[model samples]
Target: SRLQIVCWTVLVISAYLVILFIRFLNAATITDPFNITIDWHLWALLGLSASSAVGAPVIASAKAAKEPAPLQQITADGPRIDTSRYPAPVTKAAAAFSRTEAEVAATGSGVLYGKAAPADARFTDIFQGDELNNAMYVDVHKTQMFLFTVIAIVGYGALILNMFLTTTNPASLGLPAVSDGLVAILAVSQATFLAGTGVTNTPT
Candidate 1:
């Protein structure tokens, strides 16, 4: 969400700068060369992204706090956690004691309670689930969010370019207005992303 906000910000500012440059070159024909404005809807779109970025971590952390840490065993294929060992409705004290005993008995072994370092990070990680059980699976929420962000950026860029070409005075034109429908699409996309973070299939 933060990344999307930054991309939109840079796109708008860059487009504005290009217009300013054009106005500078054609100073004789234009009045108020630096008079550029950003639409309120654009600001709202950015605000939604910023809100999602801040809210996602908070939701995840809240969910994590209520769950007990699962003991993970480093297998030949990958790290695997035995969910059966820490059954549901177990008390916090019992869970803690069980975790300690498992840690001691498996000290020399590969069993542990932490994430293993990835051999290498990839951009595909963005579309993959963060949980152990579903890490290999593609995250539908993340993929949709990424696709929408790319589409929004590309579409807005083309809109700005067309405006610059068609307008008699590029400097006189305000920033392109974002439609209410596009803003709503982004809002729903971000809301779903946050919702997915809060509701996890795996135990923490």
Candidate 2:
């Protein structure tokens, strides 16, 4: 969700810069170079993205605070337990190996604390589940949000480019108007993404 907001922001800023450049090139003197008209739909799209970006983390954090501590098991060698509630391992073998080490380190000390640091992050993490049990699975909400964001960026970019190419007045060229439908689609996608973050399949 944050990435999507950054993409839209970059697109809008780039377009705005290009418009300003065109205005400078066409005129010798301008009173207000930064006075570019922005359509309300564009603002609405930005607001939606910003709201989702902010709300997702708040929702996830709240959910995490309410989750129960992870369950563990004791063994002859050491403590053996699932680490899914902690940071995820990069691979199944790594997870197994970590568990073995934990078992070996167990000295019948009933106290256990600390969490594993997350492995090197990957772009694929965006589409994967947040909870450890389903971390390897694809998240439909994230996938849909990603798809819609890409579509909006591409569609809006093309519209702006087409407008620039066909406009008779470069000095008057403002940001291209976004359609209500595209904004609506993005709004829905962001809402679902936030909703998905608030939900977890972890057994209570």
lDDT per model vs. reference: 0.68, 0.71
- What digit string (tens of lDDT, one per residue) describes model 2 on residues 1-204? 889989999999999999999887777665667778899999999999999889987776664554332355345888665555452222222253354434422311111111344464678878977653455578899999999999889988999989888998765789988888888888889888888877765443
lDDT of 1 by residue, 6-87 (tens): 8987998888888788888888877778877788999899898888888876765664445433444444888564546643
Assess the local accuracy of residue 145 in candidate 2 as a C-alpha lDDT between 0 and 100.
97
Model 1 lowest lDDT segment of ten: 107-116
Candidate 2: minimum summed lDDT over ten consecutive residues — where? 105-114
Q: What lDDT does candidate 2 reach at residue 140?
A: 93
TM-score of each: 0.70, 0.75
Candidate 2 ranges beyond 4 A from true positions: 29-31, 72-119
Q: What is the lDDT of residue 165 in candidate 1?
A: 84
